[model samples]
Target: MKEDLALMERALTELHPGLYRYNTKEEFARKIADFEAKLNEPLREDRFFLLTAQLLSGIKCGHTYLNPYNQKKEIFERLIGRQTYIPFHFRFIDGFFVITENASEFDLPKGSAITSINGRTVDEIVQGLVSVSTADGDGTTLTRLRSVDLSRENGASYAHFDLYFPIFFPLDRPEFEIEAISYRSKEKVRLKVPAMTKQERTAAMEKKYGKTPGYDEGWSFKFLKDGTGYLKIDNFITWKLSIDYKRFLADSFSRLKEAGATDLIIDIRNSDGGDAGVVTELLRYLHKDPFSCETGIRTFIRTAKADPELLKYASVYDQDLKAALLNGVPKDRYKPAKNGLLEFLNGAVACPETEPYADRFDGDVYLLTGPDNASAAFTLAKRVKEASLATLVGRSTGGNLNGFNGGSYLFFNLPNSGFEFDIPVFAYHPADSSQAKDSGIEPDVNAISTASDAGEAFDRTLDKTLRLIKEKQAR
Candidate 1:
């Protein structure tokens, strides 16, 4: 037990002490002590994992996370060992968990405010979830939930929130009651929903969201009836898929340009972010040279010293990365800012030098953003806003523009529990530090989804974006 904790402490000490990266060494010690005390208790593996994950979530670093694909999958599987999941979809709008769709056969209509599940109020569940949730940059649990837009039908936030929901409200029974008020008629409704088997849940999700997720495609560009081109970028990553993101963007702009489309709409809503390569690639077609994605990166420590085990898995290598490992370990709280390396938390070298596209879209660019526009996507929005390349219209971003912490990550396995958590080696603050810390990139024109808007299945943010796009085109 002592050995396991010693390992944890040694690992915890790697985070930047100056930035209070996750928790101070002292605070981390307290949390470790408290968690250690729970080891003696008759805690289940699932519970222990949850406890540790919640502990790590406190750090609020975007890159540092117990990979949900890895740890979160294990937790969800164990939680549903015997019971099935409450097979339905919900969107948290305004303050209520509204029924957007269902995977199983249920009486709940679209837009019904789900007040409770299994006798627990939505507030109580959400309050508990905040601690377990992964939020970005000084965001509270509520802010995290809202930023993710927990109430969406098929979004990145909903996907993550769905994983923890069953665990947070452990349903031992085969069935549970849901209480909700219909948005259409203002009538209250109650139903006993049966749990869904794994296969059943998959089918339902496939139906609720198309088998090919609406936004799953790399990207798409279609000209609106009004001659404005609408390009929806669901995510930035394309390495896993056959799609080439760089080529996709170049072709997209070429087609739009050939069509002589001037005004454009980019819906980054529901985008949880992917490779920053997508951001840089998109920017290449939009901005000129002599610009950088960020001023510099800050790094107090490096992952190699703390969790060297992760070094073997650091497959995303380049000249910059090899140089760092060869240069010897970072001794102090700061490492020399290396462009194209994962050493600096606030990376000095965010974008690789790219000459502007000989012919790029110079017409008005409308970037639709929200709480879900995060990580690299949020960073892209920051660049666009800083460069004055587009008019941002939507809710504030999920996390801040300048004070981002993403770059590289290493997963640290808890010695005692054997469950794992991730820690970002560096914290990246922006070169332009004027933006208020703890706030996401606020929209130049702020708008949120209204109740009436959802009822008609309308996108108020996109509408506002198009209105501005047309308005500018008129000018």
Candidate 2:
């Protein structure tokens, strides 16, 4: 236990200084001690690792995490079979749990209330879990707490929580009971529903989403006859595909122009973040550039210090040096891009990519965003807003947008039982700062997804965009 704590502390204080800077050493040490004291029992080798996984959840940085080293990969593979995931999508609205989607087996109706999980009230579980959630967005704390891989944090046998609700039983030989309550009447009812295996639920999810054309990976596009394009980008994991992606995007724009397309809808709901290069490449398709947003060197220095490896190279321009430089640089030097992550950097400034998009699409663009819209996606949205090329339509993005660079990890085994920890170093920030860093981009048009709006074949935001496009065409 001491060894594990020591390693964790080292990872925070020495290996990953970013994790330590906000809190004083004595304060952080006390926090660690408090955390250790909270554990009810001594951890087993495997369980220790699971706890470590839970620890990463507390940091709130989207990119930092530890993976299993040693036999953990094999253990993880083996463990995958023993556990099951509760396959349901939910959101928090008005401080109440609302069901957005569920498998037929669960039969939990849309707009149904989720009163409790495993005898614990929804609020209790959320408070316990959200502090460690990587999910970004408004109710993100709650959504992530309930919607994440719970089985990993707790044990596999108990990984699946028993959800109780009032409703008709979806099947016989029930795995769990359903209890429902009327919002107005305040009456409760109960029924038993059979639970679907995690694999079955996963298969259903895949089959359901797999039907969408071009749903393969990374950035995929679909075109509508009315000059509206639906483009879904998965992540910015690599820049090697940027040229190919740009070519395909250019081709799609040519086709849209030929077909008299009037608008573009860029869907960035599920993306967390990736290389800024992807955003830079996408800029090639826009017709105009945006106003400049200066990101001072303080932000850059902190970002550089976040990663020990980055600090190795960036130490020369530490906080003091970077601050001095920012003071000396001309204010007019920086500019915000259509994607802030793609902002151009000068010799001394750390900025988003400044790559120009092909000057092909001059029409209005509609961006479908959500809390899950994060990192690079937020950067892109910021740039688009600045350029006046697109109006964001949807919820505020998950506000944890930090300038991100690729990360590296280290593996360590717990001394007593051989539990392992993974650490990430090397956090980077864009040189420009037109948009707020921690707070995400706010949508120009407030488009929200409601529990009542699910499975309606039409989306309110899509409808709104369609109407706007028609209005523009009429003009």
Residue 315, candidate 2: alpha-carbon lDDT: 23
What lDDT, from 0 to 1, does candidate 2 have?
Answer: 0.51
Query: Evaluated with TM-score, which candidate comes out highest?
Result: 1
For lDDT, the strongest prediction is 1
Which residue runs does candidate 1 get wrong by more than 4 Å?
1-6, 15-19, 72-76, 139-143, 147-158, 207-209, 212-218, 288-290, 302-327, 330-353, 431-436, 473-475
Model 2 segments more than 4 A misplaced: 20-26, 38-41, 44-54, 67-71, 77-80, 87-113, 135-174, 180-189, 194-197, 204-218, 238-244, 287-359, 399-422, 427-437, 455-458, 470-475
Q: Global lDDT of each model?
A: 0.65, 0.51
lDDT of 2 by residue, 170-265 (tens): 223335454544333445645444455645655665565442222235577788666478777765556535447657677777776776666788
TM-score of 1: 0.85
Query: Tens digits of per-residue lDDT for model 1 on 1-475?
Result: 4455556556555443222543555786778788888877677666765676676677676555556554545445665434455666666676677666666576566666778888998778777776776666565333477632343234332355555666676777778798878777788888888876655666766777666353346478788889888888877666565666677777879888899888888888767787877887788788866455455445434343434452443333244543464454565424544432234433333665667886689788889887777788888888899889999998787755446565555455655555556655456655445554667787899887755555567788888887886676678
Task: Please give the lDDT score for candidate 1.
Answer: 0.65
TM-score of each: 0.85, 0.69
